[model samples]
Target chain A: MKSKKWLFFVILIITTPLLATTIEVCSDCQIKTIKAALSVAKPNDIIKVKKGVYKETNLIIDKSLTIIGENQPTIDGQLKGDIFKIKSDKVVIKGFNIINVGKDFANSNTAIRVQKSNNFEISYNRFENILFAVYIEKSSYGKIINNKIFGNAKTEINSGNGIHLWDSKHILITNNYIEKMRDGIYLEFASNCEVVNNFSTKNVRYGLHFMFSNDNSYLKNKFLSNGAGVAVMFSKRIKMMNNQFLKNWGTASYGLLLKEINDAEIKHNIFEENTIAINVEGSNRIDYENNNFTRNGWALKVRGACYNNVFKKNNFLYNSFDVSWNSKMNDNLFEHNYWSEYSGYDLDKNGVGDVPYRPVKLFSYIVNKTPETIILLRSLFINLVDFSEKVTPVFTPDFLIDNQPQMKPIL
Target chain B: MFKILKYSFYDLIRSRWSFIYLMFYFLLGVVLLFLNNNLSNAIVTLLNVVTVLVPLIGTIFGVMYYYDSKEFTELLLAQPIKRSNIFLGQYFGVAISLSISLIVGLGLPFIYYGLFISDKIFEFLTLIIVGTFLTFIFTAISFFIAISFENKIKGFGIAILVWLLLAVIYDGIFLISLIYFEQYPLDVFSLGAVMLNPIDLARTLMLLKLDISALLGYTGAVFKKFFGTNFGVILSYLILIFWTIIPILGIVWKSNKKDF
Candidate 1:
């Protein structure tokens, strides 16, 4: 009798199919609502929402299901509350247009909020005019991909983020467009994430703002016309590659601001038309290679407390300032970078210049001492001051010179 | 007081699931440190992990500790013991257990460094203290939340929300202010904000201890000018103490007045 019961249980377990049922939701049908369909959704089910405006707020997804919208179905918050609140594992939300997330002074409200969940896929969505377009918190192993997020954030007090992830791990954010938000992409306490192929423009603040995150990779992203390009703070083991930072022109802005970032590999990037290409402070053990800086105000600005950084095989083209250092302590190395301003000749027909290149400008020292004198940038007096300083090596570190400068541009 | 402490500690110890969770965190830290080559890199990564995970663990554990022991707390309340002592004992017990797990998980790596590698004993010690202080601050906040809310889920939710506000949203707001007032000197404003945020204060203190305050540029210089010296460090410590103590005191007051 026991053997027969066990056999029956085994057959029941084996014969049960693990298939997900598909449900369709529309704006005008008898069911007529995404929430109604979700209410009846079982675990591992799929809800397909048709293209129409569904005004809803605080929609919760607790089951391991897939919510896919057709032709970018619009989920308007109606300035009420959060659009979708997800708290389930193995969920996928894709192909939706979300907008008008309510602004709350006390809460970091978002169009889509994923909380304490795992293995989510948020892709191919359009988010606009929201406080925060999509927010992932205490979630892991998620993908935020191919989304268009835009917001008219006039002030930081009233505005939130475009795509914000907090305390989440193993996230992949790729191929997205973000514009005119407080931050295009913001991560805090989020680790082991990969950000790639995103274009962020016209943001009020940073294109990317991440703090206390580790083991992250950013590749092939374009950050343009933002207040600041990117601020990577208190992070380690970051890999940045082949990105373009352009037109992030502001008095206090840069192509990148790295604070307390360590063991980063920054390679094959381009910085064009920014006020400053890279403003590095408190960063260490970074490898910078094969980058191009064109028509920037400052190519590299190294503040104090930076240590053991290496610059190699980079091209600096027509920048007002190549390098600006706040301190004389020279722990970093600059070698084999192509400088368009390099006046040294190669006597032995070698590609390397015979004389070392001094990247630190005399004008930068003068401007640091006298901030009002920055207006004299590109003036003949500044050029003469720079030439005299180069001849006499005053106000700049004597040993802080880039040896092995390339005779010609690398590319 | 003794009974509360004994029961709290015993409860934490008896929970094999929590013990496993702590071990998982420890193993994760160990794996990350092992994979990274640079000591500074490892320290940074470890600090980040601790900052994220410790607060969460502290909040959840604290909330659960209070809610689960409601019956025991009521039983103790029926006795002749003072509520403050009971609260203190429970608080101390919870803080002690979490600190032990954190020290074992995170502090052991630094101990290994001190034993075999460079003599960065002072730095390691400072790091551990900062980590502990951060955990304590969150624990105090969690205590307030646990005492205030009748529903455990709501209390946990509020704690998480507060953590997000303190850890992430504050910085976002500061950045926005800086952008809005780009022409003005934002040093004073930023300094004020930093003073208000205990998390920022702890981070600043840790970075200062690491002697990397200069890399913070104008912000670091402002902090140094205001709080980098011995007196400044003391003031910072006082501020952090106030942040931790005031909330716990508030919880005590609220708990004493409650009709539980």
Candidate 2:
């Protein structure tokens, strides 16, 4: 009797695929619309949409269904409202070109809004001119991959983010290309997420922004020419690695802006040609290693009260100002870094300078005090003053020196 | 005018002070580049030296050349040349010689340092051009001062005073006013003030090249729009040319009306 029951369970497991039906929706099909098909489909069914333009809005999917598109079928929202609203678990959406989601200032009208859903997958979709593309709120264990999001956003107020997460956990966002949105990706109160292998460029605001997000790691991303750059604020234990921050040029802009962050690890990143490479304020216990800061106006501008940060094995090449601090006291450590302007000799030739390298210049301090004195930059008077100040420390932080500056670049 | 220019240029180039000036620049360039091994820092140092020293040297050379050439001027006045042609030719001769010394002296070391192949070539070019402009402008102003005054000592003293005023005191007054009127919007005022002074204008141009305009965070938008764009660069060049012309016109006017 037990052997017969085991055989019956095996038969049920094998025949489940045959029990689930695949419904096709196209222009000439009997189930002509996605809404009609969704109304009739049961749990664990697949809704395959063929190549046609589907004008729809406020699509509510509340079942465990797979909605797949053939030959890139387009869903046009006609500027009405959100296109897909998923409130169920184990839902998969793929291979659709969604366009023209509405912009409502009072509420976030998104292209795809996932709420309280777990184990969902949103991949291989294209979004054009969307307000908020693939916004996940209070969702967990979801994967957003290989999506192309583009918007013609001009201002921060009227547009929304490309990929926005709020209170979402354990999310994986990878291989996405996003541009010209307010922010390429934004996370607020999200934790334990991984963002990898994405390209973000030319946004009106930050390329990637995190606020109060913890234990998140982003790797191998490219952020280029945004209004600002990437910003990490009020976050803890985040890891950022192998990212390229390029050409973020503005008066107040930086390649990475860290404020109130704690215990973060930033390694193997490239910050090139930014106005300011790294702008830190009130951040503590951060480890910055093996990063390259090249051709920036100011490589590092540290504000007051930032402590216990360790900067090691970084290359600072050809920047106008290698390091600028606004305060007279420093609790941070700079060691084993390669500064292109290091002038001390190493007689033993062990690839490290014999003397300490003071990165701060008195001219930077004067510029901070009287910004108008910047007109005197490159002036002989300023150089003379700087030389005198270097010989005898008067204004700049005397303790802010790299004790072991490398003789060569930290390749 | 061309013949007079050729003769005076040859005369000045072969003189001792010109060689000393040339050697001075060459030594400064080599020391800055070799000691610092930094192209950007060298440019900054070159900028400061060029701005302050170029005007002073130009003024001193102009006054000395005028006084030393008085006998030659009297001899040339007896010739068939027009008075304006002689004075303008001599002015161009002194200006061109000083500019060549400045350029060739600075250029050799920089080119040796691979500045032409570097991205800093534009900034270096701007520095050279501005230095040349300052030499010409200050030389012409000194010529005007020398021609206006019969007494050589008075002309020399006043020319040096003019350099001191424009190069240092004018900035002091400009800063005082900027601080005094910090409540008001000073973009237009500062822009106009910078345009009025050649040294300040040259400094502004260099700042635009070095990308330090971004450090001027509050009023940077105006400067960026003005100096970051192609049209603004052209406007600045036009203004610089206008500055060059006014002093030349003053020289011609003063030279023609003088009772030589």
Predicted structure with the largest DockQ when compared to the true one: 2
Q: How close is candidate 1 to the true structure, as a TM-score?
A: 0.60
Off by over 4 Å in 1: A1-16, A28-30, B1-260
RMSD (Å) of each candidate, 1 decimal: 30.4, 4.5
TM-scores of all models? 0.60, 0.86
Candidate chain B TM-scores, in order: 0.90, 0.97
The best candidate by lDDT is 2
lDDT of 2 by residue, B97-129 (tens): 999999999999999999978899999999999
Q: Evaluated against the true chain A, what TM-score does chain A of model 2 have? A: 0.95
Give candidate 2's TM-score: 0.86
Task: Give per-residue CA lDDT, model 1, range A85-168, as digits (tens).
Answer: 899999899999998888874787788889999999999999987888889999999999999998998876778889899999
